[model samples]
Target: MQNQVRQLLVSLQKQLSVTLQSNRETLCHPVAKGDATEDEWLCLLKNHLPNRYQADRAFVIDSEGKLSEQIDIVIYDRQYTPLLYNQNNQIFVPAESVYAILEVKQELDLDKIQYAGKKISSVRNLKRTSAKIVDVGKSVAPRPVTAILGGILTSDSLWNPPFGESFQKAINSLTLSQRVDLGIALLKGSFDVSYTEKNEVQTKIEVGETALLYFFFNLLWRLQRLGTVPAIDYAEYLKVIDELS
Candidate 1:
């Protein structure tokens, strides 16, 4: 069973790497190429992740009516939290529903890493509210918000050694709000970083054929740890409607 599972994962990893690399090489128009890559990543997540979660390109909005910059891929809850807007294929997710945001690029470099961090900050900075839940005629207190994960995905890495000293330095340079928790260079490897209560940082990198599998498993583990998104405070949104009226 173990060997069979391993072989299946290996096949998946190879397929993902090849597909992403092919897109990078064949697509010349930057925007078209980027969109294609984003679609690929979104498809992977949507197919592999639990149905309770929704993945797409979206902008996150807060109760205050503020919107984050457009995000490449947003992993959000669909079971409870409602999408704010969906028109012409554009989606607006509420801050409370977001689980993670990923930026897709053709290559991974310091510039791209910093860009992804900035993009991540736009989503993380938004306000999220939790509302009470009524279950079985009982009122449950509002749940605290979970930290949203941020990441970057690319076909390949600019750094020769991928997750080396320079890569570490670039990741370390991000401010707390801009911190990236994960990165995947499909052709090279995958990496994840964690912070302790003391703000100490620990990084783990898987630099070989198992890059996709490592990323998929690690992402699932992290998402599992996050439990579920808090119940959204719809009353706050109602206030906006009141103002409009």
Candidate 2:
């Protein structure tokens, strides 16, 4: 059973790598290439992740009406907070529903890492309101908001030694609010970061054929640790709308 699972994972990784490499080689327009890359990563997450999670491209909005910069891929809670908007294929998810946000690029580099961090910060900086939940005819106190995971996904890496000192330095340079919790270069490797009790960053990098498996399982473990998102305070949104009238 375990070997079959491993085989399936390996096949998935090969398929993704080939498809993305095709996109990079065939797509001439930069925008088209980027869009295609994002779609591939988004679809991978959507197809593999649990039904409780919804993955898509979206602009996250807070109750205060602040909108985050567009995120390449957003993994949000489908079982808890409601979808705020989806019109003309443009989505706007409530900040409270979001679990993780990722930026998709053709290659991993210092510039791409910095850009991803900024995009992540845009969502993390937003305000989320948590309200009490009614469970089993009883009022339950609101769950505290979980730290939203942030990451960058790419087909390749720019560095000679992909997971060398330069790569570590770039990741370590990010500010607390802009920290990237995970990263994946499909053809190269995957990496995950965690903070120590003293707030120091610890990173684990996996290279070779099992890179995809490492990333997929690590992502699942991290998301599991986050539990469920808090119930959104819809009243806050309603109050804002009322004031606008």
Q: Report the number of the highest-TM-score candidate.
A: 2
lDDT of 1: 0.92
Off by over 4 Å in 1: none
Q: What shift in Å separates residue 187 of candidate 1 from its native position after superposition?
A: 1.0
lDDT of 1 by residue, 148-211 (tens): 9999999899897888888988988999999999989988899999988887778999978788
- Residue 93, candidate 1: C-alpha displacement in angstroms: 1.0
TM-score of each: 0.96, 0.97
Q: Roughly what TM-score does model 1 have, to 2 decimal places?
A: 0.96
User: In terms of TM-score, how similar is model 2 to the real structure?
Assistant: 0.97
Point out where model 2 deviates above 4 Å. Answer: none
